[model samples]
Target: MHTLRLSDEHLIGLARWATDRMARVERPVLAERVLGVAGHRIQDPRARADVLTAAAEARLGLGHLPRHLTQAYAAELQCADEHHKAGHRKAAAASAAKALILAFHRVAHIDGLTSPLATDPAQFTGPLRRSRVLRALRAPRGRVTASAAPPADRPMRLLLVHSANDNFLPVVLDHYRNHPGVEVRVLDTAADPATAPLAKGLGRMIASGIGIRSAYAGQVEEALRPHLDWADVVFVDWCTAAAAFLTLVDPGTTRVVVRLHSFEVFSYWPHLVDFSRVDDLVFVSEHLRDLAVAALPRLREPDAPATHVLDNAVDLARSPLPKKPDARFTLGLVGLSQVAKDPRWALEVLRVLRRQDKRYRLRLIGDSMEPGVSPALDRYRTAFAAELAPLVASGAVHMTGHTDDIAAELTNVGVILSTSVRESWHLGLVEGAASGAVPVVRDWPFFADRPHGAHSLFPRDWVVSTPAEAAARILAVNESEESWLESGHEASEKAISTWGWGTVAPRFDSLLCARFAEIPAQRRVRTIAE
Candidate 1:
């Protein structure tokens, strides 16, 4: 079907018409629906964005489109900055939040928005722009009454919040969800693809820190208020935007707890979070806790919540069977969806081990490294594939792709390798150990200079500083079937006693169930205009 071609001026006029209609409407719900219809008719990227300009006019508008379409929208944002300069702090904050959200959307990964935390060379880097944006966002002024603190015998209402990565929380979720003493609710932000990525932007957060209370506070309150009010104690599973969104408002009397897994310390989210609002901050490892505290000095502040290092929950009961007699020569590494897993390091170690005995084979039991996370990650995957291709063709490397049942996957493996440069805790290594596979953990380089890292986390004998050392350790354990079996048994026991959920759940209970409590009104987290 041939469509009539429209001039640029005509398209711009259509966008203007939509924005005019948006201004006339009261509720944004209707305007948003109407704008989307107009946007759908525009095949050109520029025209699509022109149509989106109408949506940005709403108080909590998020103009998160591809960067090309943001030009006309930028003019609207300038009005926000103009308002801010003219002392309309709240309007400026809202405008900045909408603009930043659109400008920094994760989908705009080509040039400027690739690294959300990195300072852009083209943009001004004054501190208050970030501080001003955050300050303008504000919080709920009236403390909504949360469910009362349950007695020792009653269940504590626990809400679990995570953005997209909930891999570490499964066992913990199952435990509390089934526990008679704790009631549970989980909110996976990624469950809704439309709004999920929007949470990743820091513009609203920067506005929040800017200190001028904003209309954004009311937006956050409206989205999260019900969950906040329902829970007695909210346990946010990751130190992500979901966690920050929960703390954006005062928890009223409900206690707030946040778990910091490995990667978040490298992001700006931790720095943006107001730690004084939290009741407890949990970590998967002490090394991560130390890194977070050092990364965000605010955690050391007097009102910073109590911190605890709870191991990532693992179910060891699934892997109790003995390995095959020849399992001694088998090496396994699981979960390689990120470049950081450094599968090439494991390959290097395999090459060294295979030189001594042709029987040695590496079993990679998860998805391959994801390509195109960025140009750097894509390059890493390309190089890794070149290295891996010949090895797989030679039968020295076995690619299992992905698996739902890791217990069955590790059964043939005798040695587990942790080649990551950084980790709060290596769950795959621990699980391998539980399955009677001896672990050879690399001294994770990110924290090698720190007081504690992989060396402190695992047994000295199990930790290695180099691929040659890893090869030597594997050889030492697998010299004989008897020696390998005995070593595997010892690793299995240690894995179960220490990191397994049977033992670790009690530690979580002490932190989430025991110490969690209602905050006094005087010390409650600040709302917009205290």
Candidate 2:
């Protein structure tokens, strides 16, 4: 485990060589070498910035190795911060812009690879980037005027803004579409080809923490002005680049709302979004809110957006389908496309259960781990493949890759298992419970030791510390068909009552219709002044 050390000049030379190699031949290994030099060996800020930027640019062209890109991104941002503190504004802006562009490439690459259950990157997105965002956003921006609030008699025009991810929006859309009091429209930035460049430019501006009157800002204003004018409120899902970009441009009189899931908190996107521009901030679970607040102290500031914790809306009307007789031995886990899902943990639980009763089996429902997304995921996938092959061959494990009808699939599953390393909320597990399946959740490692985590999220008896405990719970619950069915019935009732769209719709109504009543009087005055 020897670390490679190189002089600053040699590092620059190696970086240029790697970049050329990457252009001619897409070799992720060469990018890895450059990242190693940039992240570990380089000492001079200028040399480090050049090497990291080269590595990131080369990788962007080749299109892989998000971990390497993330490393370069973090290193370049640090360089930018150092130069800025030293009053080298031009150099700082250059490094910051490079880091920002690299981040855009990294986000696009990783986003194309997996579902929402993706794992944290190799390096955490620390406060360095947030410092820049704070500096940029310290200036007062226009907000929804008191006169712009929608009248109570007329329908409230609502707009849904998303950056490609619409997993949770369909339900919200359908609910609002049918309601007589609301009119909804969608603006998916990723789906629109025209705004892509503008989006990138806005990202650079935000990362640099300078530039408000740039052409990109004007373009964003031109593109979004119609939506801002048409909608009374804009709900942006995921505190990503979209949220950041929206905050940069003044929304004439439209109220802004942003929702944060789990993974965004671990990335720089959260750092880019301006809470001052957001009227409401939503988190799916309290634990995720706690994690987000800890990471971004701005969320806890006196003038910050009003925060709310709401359960993800799940459609459970069709759930609790009658289970097959043999379902008692079938364990289910949904979503394996991400490293965070930890399918191998489910396999271990299956092994433990099968050792006691050979009838026990596990079914994985979702896409397989994507290849060549990031080195960390590739390593995890390689090990997972090794562990899973034998089990699959022996017919003890089944991978039902990417199904549209999850409810139908869950009907054959008796015990639903949440074997994730981390989650804001285990949507699949809740869905399975609503389908009359007993739940066995692993104490999600990322937040397990925290005051409010998986242990607090779910019933204590439903969550376990290890595969053995999960297996024991499974065995005890399924000791008899009658007892298992009864437990599953109770689980179904709870899941439906707690997270079903019918139960959660009222909360959404409150959020959308309450008209900023939740904001403190002083905070309201501050928001108006800003």
The CA lDDT of each predicted structure is 0.68, 0.74
Which candidate ranks first by lDDT, i.e. highest? 2
Worst 10 residues of 2 by lDDT: 114-123
Give a tens-digit lDDT track for model 1, residues 486-520: 99999999999988788988877776776324322
Give the Å shift of residue 43 in candidate 1. 42
Give the per-residue lDDT of model 2 (tens digit) for 349-390.
Answer: 998988889999888898997788865577678889999999
What TM-score does candidate 1 reach? 0.73
- Could you tell me which residue pairs clash in candidate 2? none
Q: After superposing candidate 2, which stretches have Cα over 4 Å from the reference? A: 1-43, 48-75, 82-91, 97-134, 137-148, 193-197, 201-203, 207-209, 518-530
Q: After superposition on all CA atoms, what RMSD does each candidate show versus the true structure?
A: 11.7, 5.4
- The number of residue pairs in model 2 that clash at the backbone is 0
